[model samples]
Target: MKSSEVTSLSPPPFSQVLSMPTSNQGWPEDFGFQLGGTGPSYILSVEEGSSAHLAGLQAGDQVLEIEGHNVSTLGPQAVIAIAQTQKNIPPSIGVVSRIQQV
Candidate 1:
């Protein structure tokens, strides 16, 4: 997907918001989405019914922010750090997607 038609993902189509728990003994820990690349990453894929899937994430979505930090301003390490912090929260990050047009 190209960034030309990028748009913010809000009030997602499914209306199923999700978050990560701080800790769990046997939660299996599946956020359901595979975020690949180092900086300016894209979601390579999203598992069905996973938190990522429920929260409206999908393949080809461009991750725009995490927590509240812009991915562009922060380097890959910083972005990774922000993502790490969200391990215990819901809506871990904000992402832009071309799929919105669909």
Candidate 2:
């Protein structure tokens, strides 16, 4: 998919904000979740009982923003870098959960 593309239909997608408190290192890995994809990064996995899972982040959920910064044009690595450098104690992440319709 292109950097501007999101896996969704018309009427927009279901988006939510999750406030996740990170460890002293301030890394997503510390929150027990991994990110994947180039631009418009998505959650690769979420560990059970971890902060990410408790925050409602699920695998396949596309990351829309990090700490209010639009990240749809950024790659996964860039997003991770932003997360690591953010000064926010508990960063607010905006994400869109892609629900598969059977």
Best by the TM-score measure: 2
**Model 1, TM vs. native:** 0.58
Extract clashing residue pairs from model 2: none
Candidate closest to the true structure, highest lDDT: 2
If scored against the real structure, what TM-score would every candidate get? 0.58, 0.72
Cα lDDT tens digits for candidate 1, 1-102: 755876887764865555556643222235666666666777788888787677788897877877666785454455655666554555357777856663
> What lDDT score goes with residue 22 in model 1?
61
lDDT per residue for candidate 2 within 1-102, as digits (tens), equals 657756965786636554465442656777878888888798999988777898899999999998999997788889888877777754678999975868
lDDT of each: 0.64, 0.80
Compute the lDDT for candidate 1. 0.64
Off by over 4 Å in 1: 1-20, 23-29, 73-78, 86-88, 99-102
| Candidate 2 ranges beyond 4 A from true positions | 1-26
RMSD per candidate (Å) reads 13.0, 14.6
